[model samples]
Target: MNTHAQSPDKLAEKILRGVGGPENIESLTHCATRLRFQLHDGGKADQAALDALDGVMGTVPQSGDRLQIVVGGGVANVYSDIMSLPAMRGSGARPPSDAEVKAAMRAKSRGRFAWLDNFFEYLSDSFRPLMGVLLGASLIIAITSVLEAFGLIDTRATDKSSTWVFVDAMWRSVLFFLPIMVAYNASKKLRVDPWLGAAVMAAMMTPNYMSMLGSSSEVPGVSCTTNETLGSEQCVAKVFGLTMQLNDYGGQVFVPLAMVALLALLYRGLQRLIPENVQLVFVPFFSMLIMIPITAFLIGPMGIWAGNGLGSGLAWLNSNAPIVFAILIPMLYPFLVPLGLHWPLNALMLQNISTIGDDFIQGPMGAWNFACFGATAGVLLLSIRHREKEMRQTATGALAAGLFGGVSEPSLYGIHLRFKRIYPRMLVGCLVGGVIVGLLGGVDTEVFAFTSLLTIPVFSPMVTYGIAITAAFFTAMVLVYFSDYRSPEERAQANAERDADERAARDDSAAADVREPLAVGAATAAVGGSGASAGSPVAAGAPAPGEGIVLAAPVAGRVIGLDEVADPFFASRVLGEGVGIEPANGHVVSPVDGELVTAAVTGHSFGIRTKDGVQVLVHIGLDTVQMNGEGFDVRVEPGQQVFVGDLLAEVDLDAVHAAQHSTITLMTVTNTAYLASVEAHTGQDVTVGAPVVIVRR
Candidate 1:
């Protein structure tokens, strides 16, 4: 089972065979740590044999018939070795691009409810690529609003000058043709021919379709009527003896979204029904012929009805319970945006503007946006105060994007999600801003504009809008800044980590001037197994040769080999060779003399890199990240140099049990592959600082 005795080529062969030979491996690419495989049939791969293989650390069978083999720092070399094999040479495919790999990874990390995850992913993919053009159009409208506010032009006068008409067309170009774009994007998301999808939507927006509106009274086949409730005209035309509803398709996002979903099913079915050689011609020919009428007669009307139905509901809520509606929109957005459910609301906003002449949602939505920006601003201030260079940079950029571009994704993903404390504080700000908007009679905007500083003039009752957003911004900023985004222990650990990194950078700079530059592998590999430097050279600070590195028990516990650890990733040594300790008490301390490199804010894990190039990780409680630091009181900060037995954290073992997690504390040499050997001493009761593992380099 131990394939370490085999040569690199032999190891590769074993891996290839373990994954059901070269035939089963549809494609293979490797990241820095793992070999990613697109398999023809995942079930054929031998998980047990792969786990037992000497070179592989572990194997992850992912959703969508994909596989990942953890091979540590030597993944690149192993990938080359696999591809160079005689049987695999002809079977190998070109490596996937970074974006493709990232997308695949995202797919692999689907949530527990597959349908829910897929729904959100579909919506997100359909809208994400169109953001740039949407923003550009939004900014043009913002400029127009500013001009109108200053009385520069009368855009509503129907007798607009040629220059003003051209200006209107500039922004209108994006919104008017939005349906075609949405259809194209949605079709691509569903893996259908995008042009076919675009053509279906374009059919309804053509001049022939528009011509029927003016000829409704004169044309025998066309008839028009007015909707009493919405006060809008509806038209129907007879096509080949069948009555078909005729409606303007411009700016209708929901139609394309629904159409493409059905199209994917029909298109794939058609592919199966038609023969391969003649399929291309027949597929498009039959698809367009079948889809266009179905869309015009059924789907278009249904989609319009669906969008209007949702808009009407929101409209009812806004009118009857203005305060509730104001608060609800902002509150809902925070949860929706992260999962990409916000796009539906965004589509509704556009629909409302097109049908009702203005949208009421953006006014309340501004509360959420400003609150998000405020949270980022708070993080920026704290980073400045604590001298956290990385956080400061991230917060600065996120805040700028939020205020100027009205984009909240950077702040949400970059900072808020990483720290668990920022969201509640941000919600408080959202509530306050929403209440103010409601009491002030709310706000309305004629054009679809992103809720940003530059677009402020687009919203009616501008003074009321300004006051509410400012209140929201400062409230969140004050709350986040004062209470802090991380707990006291996390804050200290972060500062210590920051200090250690700064010191390391200085030392590396000083060492670089005197010594020959280290090999790329030596410089980037090993250390904390997280690609951190191994610290100063042996002569400068490392423990002398033959001395070796002794790792102490980080807590009072019954020591065991990594084989006894519960987690598969740990047991396989993909994170390096070490030991697991079934803790006898809650006290955890440093395992070796080293600089702390990682002190997870959740108080669950720590990474230490020794001056002698030995990297150790102290992980407490299996799956404690789910507990969110509820039971752990971490005391030490990262980057602080520590000797064995220095206190790192205090854990409440009972809380770990209550949270339904294992209480085992694991200490590992995360960079073991880069070392000569790592030996774990197990099967004994040990007090804190008792030697549990040894590293020989």
Candidate 2:
């Protein structure tokens, strides 16, 4: 029974039951502001009940058994609460493994372009592992670009000192051997032996293969020529009387990507054809025999032709209609990146660099990257102004990651996607920046660089790149600042919650000079007293002999036994008898007027010594200290005298949910050994100030 001490908890309970209980849930995970549930049976879930739940932003029912519960900011706390439920324990249906879950998500994709999804996923995974190295290389190039700009050193110098030579190699290493990296990554994506892919790509880069190019007359079976339009030398070599097309495969991603794909197919075929005993030896032998020849004859030439054709087509558009092409790329990237569909474009950029000596797309794309960081900057500003501690931390980390590392995934998944409003504002910034770049005849980079502010020096006419990215950054920051990322209702809710916390604080402060609580720790010998009315908010008067002193309910909700709580310390009775309340609302109030003892800086846990000689500890949530005071606001200081109903802290359960912690609040008598008896009135609903625990002498 999910008690309705408040709306959010009650809603959580209803959603659970509506979803056919914990037995129907395969697993639960939270991302930012939503609960992603993998259900055993999708048909068993009641969508209406889930929609009707308070604090539920919305429900997104995906294909198959995946369900997303948008619980706003407190999604993490709500997910924890759901998992903390006793019903969730020992669930009969086992959750899917990570691989299985990914497969299931992939299977759920349905559309005319389902193959596009798979293709993009393959491309994304292949390149994803290389993002770090790519960023490092870009930064290194930026350093050299800066050096050249300042006249400190010549980056184009070939006969410089050994140190300069090695420094140049640092950035060139990743760019020059990019094909091998791509081949390895693509092979891994195809579930083939990655070394084979690297080896095949490596064959073309070797001095032996490269040596064949200029020896057309000396080597009877070889011929070489440069393509008039493509500006790249092409060679044909005859090996064992077989004619083969050859090109320097360095920095050429198209060839290796094409080769590894074919390799996967041929390798798998050979594996099926060969006997198991010698399959390993025969599989590679056949793979090399079949794939090498086929690649040299077909895939290699086709890759070169394909890359040149695509680059030429895009370059033509950029020359004729620069504005449209410029805006198109940046806008398209925002959509493409989330689906991992941007890898092909990235590969194309590298292709342009290898063939045409430069790339145009990266310059305009910088506009988009800066815009993303700008939106994060705006959010960071808002968080500071409003004192939203969690949002502040999230935006700060994301901003740093973007500006320094040139990675957008942190901002994309961490902040931008979470708040729907950020996307529109960010798009506007991208548009403005692209238009500026296009009007300036479109910026181009002489090298393939990660389009970041730091890499601005790499772009030709650095002033153009600088101006465009600046416009993008300020546009997005200003838009987000003026309009704000959250909707009006969300802002109103936040204000209301804050106002309530303030009101509770004022109420507590105004009545600070009241009488002392019923008793101090002296209750060990003073349990003999009369009982108050059970119908009152709290059983306050006194207790009979051997009767435990009644401790008012710290929070409102259904009370479960200490053994039922998810915490080991409480469940093991190490913290004495106490009741866990699945909170309906988000507030931690004084159960009785007492001196504050332990006041955690994070505001998640508090210990109060009651006047009745009982030490009580109020824990807001399970493992919530990790949130570092994000969703909690402590109202009272340590040793401060507080009366009954005084607000000890104000919690944002939504924030707690967002942090991925359980909102099961516990109030325990820590020093039960000092008392005669400690009894709990559990297995029933409770409200703030209601008698839930009785500590007696």
Candidate 3:
């Protein structure tokens, strides 16, 4: 099925139906080219029907109720459409409960080691929400760096202007308070009281904690020593006779992540042991009392060491194997970002900036960001050349987001991931950029800045950084534009579809001039508004019986070809030409505003007759009659006036699955032969109330 002509909303509705509706969806997520559905019942999905739909590249039925529908390039729009449907209004994905979250962690099998997925997901969720503030802070640092480069301001001056200090605070506030923010998010992810986690981390950052960091003989049981090589001071203070290492926790991410994890365990354990009613008060009190000390004395020092150990290892690698380090970072990021494994490296960058006053990772990482944007630029050029409007729009937006914001997700998910050929081309660009940076003694930034065009000034040896990113951008662009993102066969099909759409558009424009405008008043008079009683048919010179009749989808799901129907009678269009929906849910709605002429007692079928004499039949399953009314709940009576999207029936789809019957719901203009034209839009995922069929007479 080719769904090129369908809108994203229509495509989403059909996809939802194909996956067995929002009720069946345990969770919904999208990546690159596919809509990942965690379904409650995978068996209810009509895989063959979904594969036959337009716009859908394929369907993958995984273990459990996991289903992935490949939409390619425009998966984000499709995902949004599905979630915005009326039936899915409140059923869209939300934060799962603690048990559900645990189950999800257990179910993730993205890698050979399942725990790897959980680890990355945990790290990703903790920092993902902080992106906005981080980007804002990076931009502030970028502005100051630009001023410094241009000699407009001396940022390094000890006696700085108040305005400069204020500007510094704007960026520093985000970085300094970052530990508390990470603690909150990490705690929420672990289903702990986020405030308790934030409070525990905050205790270390208070002025009271900062007062302990000194080598003064006046302060009892406190000592400090300077590391000659590192040129940094280390201090220890006696807390209740236990020696506590005192380190500045500003801009520390690892500490909060570690602290929150242990805190979650303790917090939950307290809940289990304490009385349910009193647990609320006691849980927070006991958790803070216990975790605060543990974190201050143990986790804090360990987290610092862990962060330092990782940063030092990378620093050593950069010092010795600079070339490998440069190439490896840029090349690795493309894969890491998608799977969310890059958070550790990101943590290291922050640690380096906090401790050593500079970070080297972001310099190499700019190569990957530019390469990703470059691939999108290539796709945009190719899309323009081929006149692929959808791809052009997607690519243009993705490229802009990447270049300006240094956010790769839009480019990666919207364009690069959809095309396999682009990755190797993009990687070549990453390698070239990395090589240039390595050969030029590498680049370093004093601030944790995003490697966007605006933040380029933040990196030292700005000329080397510029050259590397420029090379990376153009290299990927040229390679992708010349080679083409799509396979030859795919390109041919796309061109053919483009040609068809153009031809149809021309025909519609030409027809619009000669044909009379739709008789809206006449049609409305006859059919009335949604709930109003239908009046008599219109007279001549008014709209015809079939004219201006738009049949909406009866269920949320993918609309497939009549031939995809398992029932021979329906498949052959013996009753009429129409579309078949692989339902996403069991609640079927009326597809037209008309009188319910026939509502089967078994609830397997319904026939509606519009005031203008247009006839429509909605058949819910193949050979479901033998099972009788065991699974179906009829919602409308024969002769009842109904409007589009009015509930008609609710079928127990699981029962149908057990009966080994197809849950493909069919909608047909049963009197198709008499109509001038009955256009059934198929091969699209659509929501209930989305137009699926149009008739002209």
Q: Report, for every candidate in turn, its global Cα lDDT versus the true structure.
A: 0.74, 0.68, 0.72
Candidate 3 vs. true structure, TM-score: 0.51
Q: Which of the predicted structures, 2 or 3, would earn the higher lDDT when compared with the native?
A: 3
Q: After superposition, which runs of candidate 3 have C-alpha atoms over 4 Å from their true positions?
A: 1-114, 214-219, 314-320, 328-430, 439-465, 474-697
**Which lDDT tens digits does candidate 3 get at residues 1-697?**
3424277777778877887877788778764346777888999998888877776755768788888775643455677777778888766444254334333432422347756556656766676566566656655665666566577888768899899899899978987898898899889888787899999999999988888787754567889996432345679988899899998888777678888888888887898999988987999999989998998999888865654454456667888898889888899788766533455567677667778889889999999999888988999999999999988877776666577657676576456655556889999999999999989988999987667787788888999999999999999999999999876534643564465346445545554312111111111111110111111212112122445687888998988877677654455453456788999999899988887755655577776778766778788887675555569887876657999889999999999999998889887765554567677777778888787777765
Which candidate leads in TM-score?
Answer: 1
Clash pairs, model 1 backbone:
3-54, 493-637, 496-638, 497-638
Model 3 poorest ten-residue lDDT run: 524-533
lDDT of 2 at 547: 57
- Cα TM-score per model: 0.64, 0.49, 0.51
Error of 1 at 217 (Å): 9.4
For candidate 2, lDDT tens digit of each residue in 1-697?
Answer: 1111245556567778978888888777654335778898988888777766655534657777988765533444576666666666556544433333333433332236767556655555566566566656755665665566567887556578899899879977986787788889888778787888888877777777777766354666788886544445567888777778776555566677778988998888887888989986888777777777777678776766655565556667877887899988778667656533454466667667877888888988899999998999999999898777767877786676677656676576556755557889999999999999988888888876656655677898899889988999899999998898876435533443344344344545543312111111111111100111011112222234345566787888887776678755456444445678888898678886687744555677766666665667787888786665677787876557877789988999999999888999887765554456667767777778887776666
Q: Could you arrange the candidates by TM-score from highest to lowest?
A: 1, 3, 2
